[model samples]
Target: MNKIKNIHILILLIFLISIGQMSQTIYVPSIFNIAKELKVNMEEVQKLMSGYLLCYGISQLIYGPISDKVGRKPVILVGMMIFILSTFLILFANSLELMIILFSIQGLGTGVGGVMARTLPRDIFLNYENLKKANGFLNMGILVSPLIAPLIGGIISNLFEWRMCFVFLLIIGILISTTIFIFLPETCTKKQIKNSIFGYKILIYKKKFNYYLLILTSGLSGIVVFESNSGVLLSEMGFSNIEVSILFILPIPSIFFGSWYIGFSKKSFNYLMWKSVILCLLSGFFMWLPGWFKIMKIWTILIPASLFFFSAGMLFPLATTGAMIPCKGSAGTAGALLGGIQNIGSSFIAFISTFLPKNGQFSIGMITFIIGVIIFLCWWKLSRLEKI
Candidate 1:
């Protein structure tokens, strides 16, 4: 592909990558309203997020081998079709249970598109540094969803009904699906698809790359745990829908900057992960201290949370790329497992988080500490064993 064509495809890939997060976050500001409308608890409403994530994680495992068997473009289109159907169907859901089921299906729809997005730069870019740079750009594109989704969801929900948010998502799904059909080429052409079970086993059970997989999963879980709770917590603190939405957008600029820095610097993934470990510890301390002291100010959450998100800026792309390093012939399978592993940890934590004390302030702090330590130790062990 020519340079301009590559840029267009890259943008589309970013759009695909952003779809799952958009599906989740776009509806977030309206969760409280949905609960009130259904006469349900906010905690029950929060299950929608957990449901989407659980489906999102598990679905990736399926898409990887199938994409390897069929092709990236076909798998992506099928997934997006599922997303479009599920998202549009969400409008007819009359109860919370029905909505939860539909949303999980929508999450399943995002898996193929999202996993393929990760494999693109891995497919096209040869050098590790070049791959990291591409992923940074991809991460920067993802930051746009957080920046834009809440703002749009807030305004729509404030002006109309909470379900209106799905209308917006439905449109996005259609557009993305169309774009992929028209433009995306297959990246996993050379790899023959084995049995789905074999695909996952080869990608995930490998000793060499398992360390990166664990860090990727754990780090993502911590991030989601905090995010899953933030909507309710902000509402508890007396913020309105619009206010909560705006607050959620705050961390993107920092994350974007971090990704841009990594791309510009051309730093290795190992280098960036090592540097971020300290930032993770610092974020954990500040994050934990506020809740431990019962400090309820927004900044107590916002400041530390922003710091940790910025660390994610550094952390995610590196770990994702590292996880794929050993699986050159099976990018789809590896990407799927990596993404699936990511959501498994995150969704489980998010589900578990909902059951914690309503004052999840302290719980988030504890999460930060534990997640930070585990990621750092994983990196240390990977470095020692792999000697990369």
Candidate 2:
């Protein structure tokens, strides 16, 4: 019975991770066509993305504490159900305003998955190495969805309509929720549950956890910056939706490779973290590289995208582990707080990146590089603390 219980929890974790991946991945390609259909400016549509993400980030604080009290299974299922309903609304959405509202609701669902998925493994797997391995799997699952989103979105939009993209999300959500309902067991113990909701405030006060949180949150800035800028920048450079889709896939292989590399290594130190930061700097350099020589081409943009994605893959797991390691008995709160910072910081990055000049590829590249460097400085500060 004990052995069976462990298997059930592991499967549940994987399923939740997949759902988390699906929620984020399903919307990327549809953004372009959806904006056209809604008859709103692209920036208005972009605000929808920002709204979902910010809400998703903020909801982590609420869900994390609630899950610790109510039990993981109930919180997760409620989140999944909400997500399914939101996706359905998005499928039939007619106006830009409606889509934005539904997307924010969708953010709530995705936010729950994000917090629970991270917290579940930390609850089940105690050691630093095992925890890192579980996180690697979670990250891998999230990355998998993006790998296919562009292609799937392209085909569906071409054959039927952009609305089908949400329809596809509905199908995926139903299947995932059903699997969780049947197979997933509650992982939290009664004693491990928080005595009060205010426990999260105590956890956040820890010095070590706060530094790591800064790194995890800042690292995500690059992703948001890129997402907010990519469609506009790529279109200006003569890439169509399909062409952008193909270019988007360029980074998946590199990301997968980075995750695999991190997983296989036994060492978990500041060195690997620095390597990720350096790669991010290089990615920024590559983004500006073509523009520097005045020879902007399709490959120039694609290559930098590939580099940035890979660097992100390398940094995320390490930073996550660093943040959670200090929490001791508060995995749920730690996961929630970490995820909150990531999404909130990302929302800010996406919003700020919008202010950059649209015509300059170098501007995007430089902005990406600056974000990477800021994360690196956070990493450096954390390293100094570890030494002391």
Candidate 3:
């Protein structure tokens, strides 16, 4: 394939994979809507989202090395196909249990897309400058999904019905998979394909990589906690579905702006990561402290939460890029490991956030504070080790 063709295909690839992710988020407000329609508890429907996340996070480990073994194009094609089928199942879901099952499969399928989305960039761009640009583009693609999906969900659910969301996703998934089958060429080399699973195992045993993973683990835990539970929080506070949609957009502006500036800057990843980590910790502390005197309100929650994501918007790319940088031979495996560990960390935090006392703001505050402390300690250790 020609270079221009490859670049276009890559962009399409990123966009399609991103849209798959956008399918998941477009329904945050719809969770409450779905629960109400199906006569299921709202929190139960919330678990559908959580279950999707669990599969989304863990399945990356499976798909990452698989892509390394076979090829990026095939893995991506397979994932999209699975997602397409899952969405079809969801469209017919009348019971909540069926919805959760469909959501899990949707998650499992898109999980591969997420892994390949990051890994493909590394395959395409070898130079640090180009690689950084690729990472920025990848982040942008993913970030834009959440920005637009909720609005679309609100409109579609209000005008037609919630089932249209799944119908739309199903069509999009099939279209994306077909495009990949027709367009994308293989990126992984034959040498890289030999016993890729063994390579994945070896990469996991690397000690230095653990520090980078820890940094990601700590930061993402905070983000996941908010992502999994924030919908319910807002709903419980009496925000209507459309109102929740409007409020959901509040966080993305800060995240996008912060990432754009930092991602383009020439600052070292180590410095950026540390600075963002400290900001995250501070945000967590401030978020927690406000509730102690019972001063917590919507703005108080949104402001600090946005700040945490803003810092995350800065730090996450660095942590992801940094973790993969140290991998000498198996970049795909390394990418997978970084992503997989980050998901595991996020899931752990989500679980904690779920059971935390919802009686008052104190529980949520405490969880955020603890996550911030963990991130701070991890960043300090990483800085010391790197002599940064």
Q: How many residue pairs clash in each candidate?
A: 0, 0, 0
Which residue segments of model 2 deviate by more than 4 Å?
1-11, 193-195, 289-295
**What is the lDDT ranking, best to worst?**
1, 2, 3
Which ten-residue region of model 2 has the weakest summed lDDT? 19-28
- Model 2's alpha-carbon lDDT is 0.74
> What C-alpha lDDT does candidate 3 achieve relative to the native structure?
0.73
In candidate 1, list every pair of residues with a backbone clash: none
Candidate 1 residue spans exceeding 4 A from truth = 1-3, 190-196, 266-268
Q: How well is each residue in 1-388 modelled by candidate 2, as lDDT tens digits?
A: 2556655676666666665555554556666677777887666666776778888898888888887777788888888888899988887779987877888888888788778767887778766776676667567666656556766776777778777877888888899889888877778888784635587678667777787777777667766666667767766677677766666667778778777777777765577787888888888888876766766666787788778778778788777877776565677777898888788888877777766677767777777777767877777777887741
Which lDDT value does model 1 have at 366? 81
Candidate 2 accuracy as TM-score = 0.92
Error of 1 at 348 (Å): 0.3
What TM-score fits each model?
0.95, 0.92, 0.92
Q: How do the residues 355-388 of candidate 1 rate in per-residue lDDT, one tens digit apiece? A: 8875747888888888889888888888766544
Where is the poorest 10-residue window by lDDT in model 3? 320-329
